[model samples]
Structures are given as structure tokens and as C-alpha cells.
Target: MAGTTEPYDVITMGRTGVDIYPLQTGVSLADVETFGKFLGGSATNVAVAAARLGRRTAVISRTGRDPFGDYVHKALREFGVDDRWVTPVERYPTPVTFCEIFPPDDFPLYFYRRPKAPDLVIQPEELDLDAIRAARVFWITGTGLCEEPSRSATLAALEARAKSGTTVFDLDWRPLFWGGEGGASGAGGATGATAMATARPYYEAALAHTTVAVGNLDEAEVATGLRDPHACARALLDMGVELAVIKQGPRGVLAVHRDGRTAEVPPTPVEVVNGLGAGDAFGGALCHGLLAGRPLEDVMRHANAAGALVAGRLACSSAMPTADELEKFLASR
Candidate 1:
């Protein structure tokens, strides 16, 4: 969204890793014969998505001194994402995620993060404040707030938005990473109540600093303890979000804007393939529209089309469509 003079249009800072998926669907990870690997992590996906949409994008994160890290770099460059800020550390190993595919993506992920991933070590000192402040749009996710230094660093990056830029919070919440009384390892597992209480303060603080908050119904519920879309939007808006959106898969996305305006884009039909990448696609396209300063209705519809294009695709990052592709898809509907 930044003009040609700016170094980047969109910038993202957060966790990134390798995603390994079993090639065969309807099979368990234990039984899968072959697998495919790709660049992943929510923020990384959003970067790739926006880049594919023709925005100059950059990602700020670290990977381990391993082949997986190499793969991540190559994948980002191949997708036109600037990885100049992507670091590689010697002792730590890059995180790897593996999942068994069920039809339409009923995939449960197994994250290999026992020793702590390098991304969790992104200290505040390492950030490029100039790059963060210069971008037209900056995005971060809840997972980045799950740990310490990364959490501090993520908050610091948000500071740039205050100066000039749009800050987007993708509530990429993973209960498994929140580790404690309401964390993944809890005896009976973290309940919705515990999860809500544990996640609220963190979400609230970040939401206070962010301008745009994007999440699905469950994510909104976890962050605000509200299931009703309207209440959820109000709570987020109360936290100072200029715009709050709830992405309802089959129904549509409900959006509440600052000027007492709201917009909804009903689901666009597509042959469902794997549902893993739609949200990321939505984030990318949404950045495009917002950066263009397009109206809320146009923005919502454009974002819906972007996600719909990926819903029926085979992979994640590569599934994101270009601007021309998105417009064509929308024209069809």
C-alpha cells in the first residue's frame, strides 16, 4: 500500500517456521507415506499473501541454523517477500510443524518446539524501528505475544504504528502455546473460561495499541469473552480498535468501524479443498484494501474474494491470488 518510494507496503513481525504436511488426505500422521513442506507461521503467511497481491512486503523474525531455515528464506524470496530482517541463529533449531490432512483441512498440528524456537528470542534490540515505522501496514499475531522477549519486541514494534502506519492484530491464538493453568498442558486441557481469562489481558493490551483487529468468531470470543459477533466487535472497538472484524466461515465477515459504520460480506462460494490458508489470505487482501484507503464495503468484499480463492487450493502461501486474480474472481460472483 505504501507508494513506490517507500521500502515496503506491508511489514510483519512474529513467529515463522516450516510446515510439513502429509501428501495423502484422510490419513494419520503415523501412516502418511509422503509429505510436502512449505513456509508457514501466521505472520509469515500474511507477508507472502500480501506480496502475492502485489504489495512490497517484508518479514521480521528468526529461524534456526538448519535446513528448515534455509527453506524458509528460499520460500520467502520466491514469493517476493523481503527477508533481509529474517535472522538465523546458530545453537537453536528452527521449529517444524507436521499435520495429517483430512478432507477440507481437519489438520491437527504437531509443533516441534521443545527447546524453544528462535523466533521466541526476537529481542527488542534486534528490531529495525525505521522499517517498522516506514511501512504502510504492519501485522502481528497473538502467538508472538505468547512468549517473553518476542512479546516485548512485538509491543515495541506496535509503537511504530502510533507514529505513522496501520497496525493489524491477527488473533492467531493457539491455546497450546499459552502453557500454564489454562495452557495446553493442563490436566483436563484449558477450558474456554480459563483460556479467556488467560488471553484477555494480553489481547487487551495489544488491542489497545492496534488500529485494526482481525479474527474469527472463536478468536474474538477468546480475546473478549463474547460470542455474539456484535458484542465482540463492541468490546474490541472499546479497546480502541478502529475496526474489528469477525470472520464467519459460511455466513460472512462482520465488521464494525469507528464512525459507527458496519459492513458484512457474505461468504463467496468456492469448491472447498483445504481451509488452512483462507484467513491468512484474508489478512493480506484486507491490508491491500485498507492501504488503498478503499471504502469498508469494498475492502470487505475484496478480502472475501481473496480468502475464497485460497479455500479451494492445495497449499497455503502459494494459494494466495494476485490482484488481477482477485478482481476476476469477484467479477464472477
Candidate 2:
């Protein structure tokens, strides 16, 4: 708690799970015989990425009080994130995700988080308002809004920022855990109409408090049901979002400000290896830009380049680049 200073760069709260990725690409999840494991979950991924970039970061969530919980704790420490707010709960097992990642194509995730994952136990009453109020940036995800107590807690985390004027960003996540009975599948795939309807209200509420919203093209359709990037951006602003980012693979990203300013970041060239954690990288780099007080154009470029670097690597947390590494990668362009 001693390190809870004014604007400690970044603070985040949401899902914390283990990711099991197939070691070999271009094969089915069932066909793959070997898998690689790493710390997973959108909010935690963003926290790790920001910390790797030398941002002072803190996390708020719960992990199962078990060995898996220990792994999550160790991972956070390894990344230099302040885990003081990360709680461990009893009885439930930690959630885990399985993905099939083929280069230049698809990454399908199957999540095992049901019955009472520890992250869902996070309650608004347990939140430390001071940390949320004083942070320079707060990152949230749609995954937290998919359920009950966590939903309330997610909204509460934004309340202090709402008053403090902290820059709050929304990361869109369409996990299999949502849209009951295998309804929502794939990122931005129209596979979950029922799930989309179920999630809209919560996402709209989330956007109401967000200063910026970031996600891929499909992620935008999944969150807002608007396919056109510009329309999606406009819809987000209408919901009170100050900035909206609609990511276009290969073509780059288009950012729209509520003030009518628009900028497009050119894509960073890279050999596609795995596209699993690129969005998390973008979220972290965007935090870096905002915390450093860079121009909007520069922010998108930093984020775009960060994402490209991650796409060329494997795993999630390990793929997050350090500041020097990212600068080096950018310098090459």
C-alpha cells in the first residue's frame, strides 16, 4: 500500500486465468498433442504488458487459493506488477483457456470458467477507492461485465475514476464463458446473437465511464453490433467514450475522438507467428502513450507497433516487449 502514490501509471481489474496454447500451429486444438502454458486473461495481460514497459501497475482481482493461484501470483511478481490488491479465495479452481493459434488466420479460445471462479467473487465493497482514484490510467474489460458480482465491481472501479477524471480504457473480450450454452464463439464472429444482446447493456454502461475503447473489428461488432468501423466508433462516442479504436488487421487501426479528430496508424510489418496477445500489447502501449502524454497520433502508432511485435512471437505475457525492445523495434521502421 505504501507504493499507492498519486497516478501510479496503470491499474486494472478483471479475469486472471491460465492459457494453454498448442505448441504446434496449423492443427486443431484436439489434434495438437503438446501445449504451452502462460498467464492469461485480458485485464492481467494488460497489467503485465504495462509493467514490462516500466509503468507502475497494480491489479485488482481474486485467484483460487490453490497452486494455480500461486502460479498467477508468481507470474505477476515476475512482471513487476503490484499484486497487493490480488486476493485469493477458497473452494473454486482457477479458470483456464485453451486456444488454437494458426499464423495469419485464426485463434479460437475455449475457456473453462464456471460455477464460481475466484475473479467473479470480486465485490465493489472490497475495492480500495484510493488506488482507483489516484491512478493515472485504469483499464477494464468486457469479460468482467459478463456476470453478476463482478459486474457490479467492474462498474464501481470506474466510479472513482469518473470523479477523479482518470483516463479509463475499455478492452473488449468475447470469452466462451459468456452467452450461455456455447453461444458466443470467435472474436467478432456473428456466432452469438443471444450473447451479444445479453452483453450490450453492460458494455454500454462500461462505455459511459470509459475515456477510450480499444478492440479489433470483430470485437467491435461483438460489443456494439456495429460492423462499420466508423459507425462503431461513433456509437462508442455516443455512449460517452472520448476515444474509440477499431483495429483492422494488416490495414492498421483507426482512432476516432469525440471531438471529431481522426487518425490512422499504419501497420507494422512482421512475419505472422501467432496472433494471440497482440491486442493486449496494444492496450499496454496505449497506456504507455497516455501516461507519457504523447500526441494521439503517436499513441496509436506506438500501440500498433507493439501489437505487431507481439504477433510475431508466441504466448501472451512472455511476448510483451520492454520499453527498450519496443523502441528498438520501432526504430527499425
Highest TM-score: which candidate?
1
**What's the CA RMSD of model 2 in angstroms?**
2.7
Residues 1-333, model 2: lDDT tens digits: 344556668888888878988899899977999998799888898899999999999888888888888999898898898888888878678888898877786887777776667887888888887878788888888778877678898888786568355455554756455654322445433555666777777887877888888887777876678889899988878878888898988888999988878998889999888888898999999898878888889999999889889999988888999999999999999
Off by over 4 Å in 2: 1-6, 180-190
How does each model score on lDDT? Answer: 0.84, 0.81
lDDT of 1 by residue, 1-333 (tens): 112346589999887889887778888988999988888888899999899888999998999988899999999999999988889878788888887667664767788865677888788888877778778898989988877778899888887557367889999878777764212445223554565566678888888889899999889987888889989999999988999989988889999998898998898889777778789999999999999999998999999888988887767888899999998899998
- The estimated TM-scores of all candidates read 0.93, 0.92
For every model shown, the clashing-pair count is 0, 1
In model 2, residue pairs whose N, Cα or C atoms come closer than 3 Å (at least 3 residues apart or on different chains), thus clashing, are 188-218
